[model samples]
Target: MWQIILKRENEISLSRQLFYAMKDMILEGQIRSGEALPSSRGLAKDMSISRSTVNEAYDMLETEGYIVTHQGAPTRVKEGLYLEKHQKHHEEALFPVITLADKPYKVDFKTGQPDVSLFPRYVWNQMMYKSFEQLSDKDLGYFGTAGYESLRVEISHWLFRKRGLSAKPQDIFITSGTTQALSILVTMLSKAGLPFAVEDPCHRGLLEVIENSGNSILGISVDQEGMKTALLEAHDFSAVYVTPSHQFPLGSILTAERRIELIRLARQKKFYIIEDDYDSEFRYVGASVTPLYSMDKEQVLYTGSFSKTLYPALRIGFVILPPKLHSEWMYLRKHLDVQNPIVEQAALAEFLNQRKLDKYIQQISRMYEKKRKALTTSIYECFGEQCSILGDETGLHLVLKIPGAHFDEFFIEKCQNAGIRVFPIEHYCISKGNHMDQLMLGYGHLKVEEIQKSVSRLYNLIMDTE
Candidate 1:
């Protein structure tokens, strides 16, 4: 009799377990291909299982083409079912698999991280459930890759109301995030032997999207007004990438004059301007700055993400493409991921249609403003006159500059060893020797208590180092 044991107490049916056990044994060559299987009655008697259970297992095995039986012949494993036995290491996991969970940091101030605890998950979950229940059967099948149209229209409405940028629904297409948008953009914009003009000390993740795509980068220096638009040379780059609303890492808004200069340069050179309007919402001061895309939709290819405003795991963002690039973008998108999952898109569309997103932004914006204040106050208390905050206005994170304090690679390593995770502005720089006196502090995810304690610890660590 075949040595097949079934756990009656197990949640899975006995027949399923027996079938899988036998199938695996056959595949692993434990039972050779073409080997005769024990008769159902004999297996039942040997294993002490009911005859019906063994019969069901045998029937499944036969139905699946794993085994063949003639009216008068014994049930046997099919040819080519045998595979080499896989070697197992004792050091490797064999029992119930255990997965490692991320260890909680004593003080985590990671950038672009929103406070998920404050997100209106109950409402979102309800909307998600509703979308699932309300989505028609046809709506689930082969939906166009351009994204849910309702979501695109909602994004268009949001841009006008929130960012003061007017884009038609046709111009706005959904994306996973800025990363995917950039990934597709680099391919479309790349030209032979031409470099892309990117801000020096930009987000590392963004820098890679261009570099990893085999495109050369033109590292332009950034000052108080974001990328030094005055230094940008026309007819040189394929496209100029900028975070106009609020700069990344350095947190400076591109000046009105500079933005105009960039648009003119792009128009003259026949190049495009890739505007990454990351986290334009939640401005602490007056209104959020007008996006460069707002100036000229033809020249500026706009990208925006909800990673900061909503929870990051949502993985929803969008790009505004001019009519010229629509077909290629659709083709690329169709093959890329073939569109985002319909449920989340539908839920988000409902959320926007109902203005729950508006209410949520209002709630979280206040919390972040408070957190931003806590960080700045703690920094002042800790370092006093020694440090000054960089960047104009608002975002999730800002640059903390202690002018005299030298922060280098060794300093960063020391902090890591001390269980403190802090990123120096230099870490994100393409050209070195500048901004070494600064550290990037992201406070969006931190509570006031955590911010104060972490800033205090950070001060002591800096003091010890300097």
Candidate 2:
């Protein structure tokens, strides 16, 4: 009789439970190495289950090298199958429960995240449901390495209409998100043998991504106009990253003259520009500012994402590669993720085709614009002449500069105690000792009332620090 008992009502699948039970026995040496396992037919009869179910359990063990079998012979536990048991460390649990937000902050001005509650989930669900209703054999199989071609075409048109950038569908490739696209590009662009020139006080998460790839990052100073291209004429670099549409932390648009200057520098120095046009859709001002990719397609690798606009979990973004790099990008992407899931791509394509995305962006822009006003007005009321706001022209966040105030970790700790969580601009600086007096406040996800309350709390924190 089989030693293991099956649970029919458990949430875990039967085959997986069976496999785990056998694996535990093997590792504990209760099932001795070289001992033959009961035949599938015998075990199935003992357990009152189908032979196929028993065979599946054996197949998993065999595939994992836990057991061995020869032609026309019974399966036996592999030698050295026993593993020494170690006491479980609570922190080392396979799925340890980590607290994402332990502190009950009254308001968190976290940047680069949108209020997704307003997204039209009903419409999106309908589109996704339709994709499954008409699912095809090819769609469920290896559709292609590049991406869903129709989605690519739709993205190409969307970019053209939204940002005035014309790109062929063949050159567009889908990725998991903006980070993946930039990560892949890091590998491809590293061959040029020069450090990546990035903005000095740029996105810290992005800097971590570049550092993880073992690439050197050279800091380019950013002014009110954005990535100071004039700083690049002296030093050589393989590539430069800019948040041109609305700069990252600083939230300044790259000026037209500087945009042209960047293109000229890249051409003259033989470098590439990595434009992260993230959150451009929510610009509170004029139509989304034109991207650098529009100035020169061949030199710029453009990245855009649907995470902020639709929802962060969508994990869908695209990159427009030049014709020359298409082959390498395709090979690398195929090996990395294969391709993005088709169901969402199809759903997003339908989302774009029906002009729902355009309407969604329009509505959210107005909502965020009002939140931005509330935030600035609150800052003025609280600190009056003590504080100044920058980069309010666009983006979900703005820079609040408090002159003569050096905000540091101590200041942040005080804010935490007061039930406020806001980030100082110095945290994002690659070169420190600068921007210690400034803080970045994101208002897009905060309600009008929350913004008003958070700013007042922030003012008190600043006052206490001084």
Candidate 2 lDDT over 1-466, as tens digits, reads 5479889999987787888999999999999999999999998888888888888999999999999999999899999989978668844786677889657778788787788879998999999999767768988888887888888998988887877788999999999999999999988888455789998789887888888988889999888888889999998876899899888888888999999999999999988899998887776666668888888989999999998888889999999989999999988988897988889988998899888998998889888988988988999999998779988887788999988888888888888888887899999998887899889988878988778878877777777778
lDDT of 1 by residue, 1-466 (tens): 5566678899999999999999888888888888888888988889888999989998899899899999989988899977765456643556546778754666666787888888877999999999999888877987878889899999999888888789999989899988999999999999999999999988898788888999999889999888998788644987899998888889888899899899988988899999998887889998778888878999999999889888788889999999999999999888888888899999999999999899899998888889889999999999999789976368889889998888898998888777887889999999998988999988888887778899999999899998
* Ten contiguous residues minimizing lDDT sum, candidate 1: 85-94
- Stretches off by above 4 angstroms in model 1 are 85-100, 129-137
TM-score of the candidate numbered 2? 0.86
Q: Against the unseen true structure, what C-alpha lDDT does each candidate score?
A: 0.88, 0.87
